[model samples]
Target: MDIKNLSLNPNYNILVTGGAGFIGSNLCEAILKNGNSVRCLDNYATGKPENIAPLLENPSFEFIEGDIRNAEDCLKACKGMDYVLHQAALGSVPRSINDPFTSNEVNVSGFLNMLIAARDAGVKRFVYAASSSTYGDSKNMPKVEDIIGKPLSPYAITKYVNELYADVFAKTYGMETIGLRYFNVFGRKQDPNGAYAAVIPKFVMHLMKHESPTINGDGSFSRDFTYIDNVIEMNVRSITGKNPDAVNTVYNVAYGERTSLNELVELLKEYLGEYDSKISNVEIVYGPERKGDVPHSLASIDKAKSLLGYSPSYDIKRGLKQAVDWYWKNLQ
Candidate 1:
């Protein structure tokens, strides 16, 4: 990240909730590289310790091992921070379907806790992770931020409530907040070993092992599989943006293109095959469509482009190659 190009101050203090997780840890690394002070708050519930282990060596990075569910932890994490990047949330649709209580407790209540803490700490801006699932059951291709449909799952409800709370907080308390609705963000450091692991990383790991990965529906289900660098750029831009119009609203952080599961698998095989030719012959299995899963997800990134000047450098093919390389070197 070019601090000068982004117009970011090198001395700003930033707090990243869930800093031990995939997205948050990546944010910490980028911010620290830009010469900013970073404090991370995470309980390691879903966050992995290995993701953040290397960051501990950095003098500018601080990790607070605490849960967002605890108000005191949230308060401590928010104090003395210029901006808050709240990325802490329980993040699986299937997991939420099986365990709504835990999902609500963390995604919704914990999110509220972070908001109150940031408000009290007088943080300049609070940028949080919203979800594409918030556009539930809406058949609109290239989903615009303003035209959201009803939520399809409990996890979706929590993320949607975040936008609502952010708006209300801005109006009532005069807080500067921005919500980024990420669409299927995947890249290095994303876990592929969980029951609710995201498709990209999970499939990558399986393909590396020469195992068949199951696609939920007929290979037609598609997603706007965003890269992690793009997501990191959005978080940084949200904090530093000078536009008042961009401060209070939500923007879709995506590549603005959709890739079907079949295309995604083929791309993964093609990329990984460069390392191991045998991977090219791996078969993909089909199964029942996932409950609460959308048929297609494609975002219109015009709002992010116009508002924050977000220009995503890596599309799926470009980003997937990097991701595959990382997994091959690290996980294999």
Candidate 2:
């Protein structure tokens, strides 16, 4: 079966939880671009309709204003869908630290609700957004899927629980599930305004406004910083790749290269400076490290490549350039 056709079939309707969010919107667009039908379910708590505004005109796309925290919403969203991309969650360490209970309700309980609903709906595959934070405190340079460490934050605990629950569902319910453990994803449509905004977008936004961006702890902390396109490719592969050996496994979705904050800032300045010279001199302010923050994260994509034919198309520099260009044109 053609992968694109599989995603679009009326019989294979896809439900993308949090489909209005940055990553989810990108995934939705990709699915639609491939002639697939997609129903986006989002509560708009952290997602913006503007992110998906362009797709509203597409006949293949449907939007449902809903929350994953509600079992009824999940059940309603899962009805007759062939695949479920569970991307909805309360992300960010600080956010979860400040509101652990809300995070648990949305991330843990919400995830379980989706899993059960998808199983009951008899969806062909249940693919959820797992996280690189699951590798917390492992001290491993390139984290592998089989090895993990203690979760550092409530958010981490919730994501780690997704994998655990998925494993259980596969054994108990005989469901086919895959978890994509994303590493520091950044790209177009990423929200840059929130206090909990991710590093790349936040820095890009600050530089665009000619403001200094804060660098938590030292600038030496590094990340894998996988681009959105790479993530989309992984999602499509995970959903359609028919290899029985690759089913029901977790794979790291990343570029497999580490870029430090210092280098990242320099690169961003270089890229954004081409559009405005004033941004080049924007200095970074160092501050106390935030709680539950990891010093470095790099993923081993060997498993994804060998098993799923996964190949990342963008490195940090190229990805940041694309992201910065988008922010400059759209945000400004």
TM-score of each: 0.99, 0.96
Query: For candidate 1, which ten residues in a row score worst on lDDT?
Result: 1-10
Give the clashing residue pairs of candidate 2, or none: 8-36
Give the C-alpha miss distance for residue 263 in model 2, angstroms: 0.5
Q: For candidate 2, write residues 98-172 as lDDT tens digits.
A: 999999999999999999999999999999999999998998778999999999999999999999999999999
Off by over 4 Å in 1: 1-4
Q: How many backbone clashes does candidate 2 have?
A: 1
Q: Give stretches of model 2 more than 4 Å off.
A: 1-11
| lDDT (Cα, tens digit) per residue for candidate 1, span 1-332 | 44456767899999999999999999988898899999999999988889889889989999999999999999999999999999999999999999999999999899999999999999999999999999998988789999989999999999999999999999999999999999999999999997999999999989999999999989998999999999988998998899889898999999999999999999999999999999999999999998999899999999999999999988999999889999999997
- State candidate 1's TM-score: 0.99
